[model samples]
Target: MSDAAAPGQPVLADLTTIGVGGPAVRLVEPTTGDELLAAARDAFTSDEPWFVLGGGSNLVVADDGFDGTVIRVATRGIEVLSETDDGVRIRVAAGHPWDDLVAETVARGWSGIEALSGIPGSVGASPVQNIGAYGQEVSATVVSADFLDADTLEFVRVPRANMGLAYRTSVFKAGQSHPARPGVITAVEFELHNGGGVSEPVAYAQLASALGVALGDRVPVADVRDRVLALRASKGMVLDPADADTRSCGSFFTNPIVSPEALEGVPADAPRWESSPEAQDVAVPLGELPAPPPPPAPAAVKLSAAWLIEHSGIPRGFSLPGSRAAISSKHTLAITNRGGATAAEVTELARFVQSRVASEFGVLLHPEPILLGAFL
Candidate 1:
């Protein structure tokens, strides 16, 4: 990060998969744990807007730009804290690349996060959204997270119960509404099964079919990780700069859940599924699905976000306002900056998609990325 501006280095264009955003006021990269702590502490007291920049994957900053300190979490450390015949415990620094960690864990014969392979971001951000894919969420394997309390500046440990994990939310996300803590994620601890794949079953159908295994079937950890990466790459969910479809912050919207009454009204053609076991409600079509030939159109149940966007008339490559930002032609869910678009241009695209989908399907789309300057 020291050579941040050594000529021909359009930092944002190269760093983020989306290829947008302005230059940082000052970029802080701490290579060690102590350094990270010190940087956070200094930012805590400095009269400047501080953002704990992680992987810089899941972000949409304004072109007008952030007029504050950008503390990039660059600390690097990973270790097997302890192990047993049944399980292995691991510790990963927040700054570690999430997908790389998954690959390493699978390579070592540990299961649990294999299904989350290829997801772009820092290890710390995984807990923020409980990042999930192929039917497995990081929350399932996370034993606890060691974080720096944004307010008190003391290192605090948030266990599973206190983590407030849910559909794309956690204690820090929901709790932040009440008040802001230093909210800096420092490290994550995971207890993974050592026997075969993982204790948590594979729930996404695409993954099962891709691996030629049944839903809930356990496969080799490496195989699961590989298949998950392939599946993600197919949908542009994986970060691949060469592919326009991947010029996005992964999925743009969370799959919308509906109440039982709402489900009753959806067209019979939509996928209908449920979120939990005890809940007496069914999930119906909410959006579009990526082009994966074998999955039988996802049933008329839990509607795929990609499908909803397409059906809503927002096809890939859709754009507006004479801007380069466009929805990737390969996947409707991802809106790309097309090499030179600004945050404002992307927001315009997002707003247009949101309006179109909500009007057509009556389902409001919430952006997956955390917006710093604007909201729809």
Candidate 2:
């Protein structure tokens, strides 16, 4: 194990983005996969609680802190494994900053992940959440991941198909019920097209509007990155130390998906989108003849959590009495720490938001971040 894993470790407040967690009993920074495996073994065999930390961008730890080992994956490397006619295949270590890799791929004119620019956290955490934005999810391009299976205590390579990747979760994120199946992602491989200078077709409407192009039009990859960065900064999604609004977990809640029956009491004007049965009741393009309808199918609808919060009388920047945490002034979806907020304060604000939305709309907003010794 690395020397940092010794006693008298730094507080988790210095490790996470929101800056609110308490001290860890022991902190280990593993610079190699073997070192990481050894550290995990030592902690597990000793019957001590342990947690793996990545960029710490998407976690909220309790103020009382954890009384166990904290392994910080600090291994670093990026290797080009192959360049086929279809695309380039590369493996990135878990410690590599996610946005830096996106920038590198864009600079090299790779097409698949150009739209994922400016997201925080590490590559290993991406598959855990199946991270996505502006219509592109990391699951789309992942070839496989190398992980240490806690069950066997051995290294294994799992293909993307077996990862159980869904909207914002995977099998790696199993809860307490799967105690014997804990796994730590070591690295991820991706397949990206050599698009020369172009990017994948613009798939999100807001992004297309920002670039002054129609949906599905491919623009320069560099331009896509710049536009995405500008858009994220506008909403305080980009990380900036001087910006208080950026001191958040990006979007605090995932867009809630509901069945059609659940929408009966919802307002007609509420912002929603079709999540399943893609062509269900959708209008055809002008001047195009409508094709024969397929058999009726069930549809899943996605509702905007921000809209629910705002309509439930919780505006942007809303905070409870004397709480140091407040919703982001730029976006209702984010809860930010004004300064010196505690984990309890953040949890209180989140619970308040969830209660208000649920009471008003019968929809409970679930937190997107992985809560550590904290809940909403």
Candidate 3:
């Protein structure tokens, strides 16, 4: 582990997708699990604050930068611990690129994650964020995650049930507010199906339409992966150095799960979805669409944040006059860095968007990225 800063050392901006943050006071990149644990232990033991950076896809750091140690999880490996007729259980190192695992799984006929293609980040960030897209979430297949508990400085394995998996969050991401042990994840295990190379049934409507199939249809895993990648790329969700729209956190805000009463003023045409995992997984009847449900008291409904933002008069690509930060041109959910934008500019734009949505819809949107030394 090296903590010395050099004249041309990389800054947090250079490491992050949005390219906005300042430099790390001390940077630690561990390429092995043992090194990662040691580095984490040292950081935790130190008086200085610290953060574990993954693939850097879902972070927004302040322009002033992190004042303490920043440990980058860079370990890599994929190990199959067991296999059966039904499925295969594999353990992945925390630093492994997330999409690389998805691609590998699809190529090997492992069907669980085919629908989650094109998401950027490290495998370790999966359970932490409970990352989901196109109707697939890591919680559905994750068996366990190994961690080096900071409080005790002992390594432990946490089962899926103990992770507190929820929409876009888990115990790992909850920080001090949660009762669960806090630590840095070292690896994750997942059980993926071997369904004769076929993917799980398509549960999301858009994905089904893209594949020219009805909901509940099963297609080749490779095909599912290909289409998902294409869809994400078109929306600027995929990482591309040439695409300025991709220079931001994948999504700036989480889809708010709110009381039905919060939707009182939202337009009847606004999109809504059931917030429960089971409900979200069920496919709608082919060729039939249900009318929007009226706001029902006590039932949680997930609203489309994009719809709210757009309806609030914030169009895609909207930017404050002369500001370097702007909404993504391809998708309204992201706030992009036009060029050399600072974290302050990004947060300013974010606050503007939040105010508009809250004023127009009476519902507040929460940021999806892990902000370091940054506030909304």
Residue 38 in candidate 1, Cα distance off native in Å: 0.4
lDDT of each: 0.72, 0.82, 0.85
By TM-score, how accurate is candidate 1? 0.86
Q: How accurate locally is residue 120 in candidate 2, as Cα lDDT from 0 to 100?
A: 91
Question: Which model is ahead, 1 or 2, in terms of TM-score?
Answer: 2
lDDT of 3 by residue, 1-376 (tens): 1222356655888889998887778899999988999999999898998899999999988777777889999999999998887899999999999999999998889999998899999999999999999989989999999998888888999999989888887889843134545679999999999887999999999999999999999999999999999999998999999999999998998887766656687788899976652112111121123233333344677889899999999999999999999999999999999998988888889888888888887776777887776341
Pick the winner on TM-score between candidates 2 and 3.
3
> What is candidate 2's lDDT per residue for 186-256, written digit by digit as tens?
89999999878699999999999999999999999999999999999999999999999989888888787
The alpha-carbon deviation from the true structure for residue 353 of candidate 2, after best TM-score superposition, in angstroms, is 0.6
lDDT per residue for candidate 1 within 198-261, as digits (tens), equals 5357788878898887888877888888787787777778777577778888777667654444
Q: What's each prediction's TM-score? A: 0.86, 0.90, 0.91
lDDT of candidate 3 at residue 290, scale 0 to 100 = 28
- Per model, how many backbone clashes are there? 21, 1, 0
Report the candidate with higher lDDT, 1 versus 2.
Answer: 2
Identify the runs in model 2 with alpha carbons over 4 angstroms from their true place: 1-7, 174-181, 277-297, 374-376
Q: Scored by Cα lDDT, where does model 3 land?
A: 0.85
The local lDDT score (0 to 100) that residue 207 gets in candidate 1 is 85
User: Which candidate has the highest lDDT of all?
Assistant: 3
Clash pairs for candidate 2 = 5-27
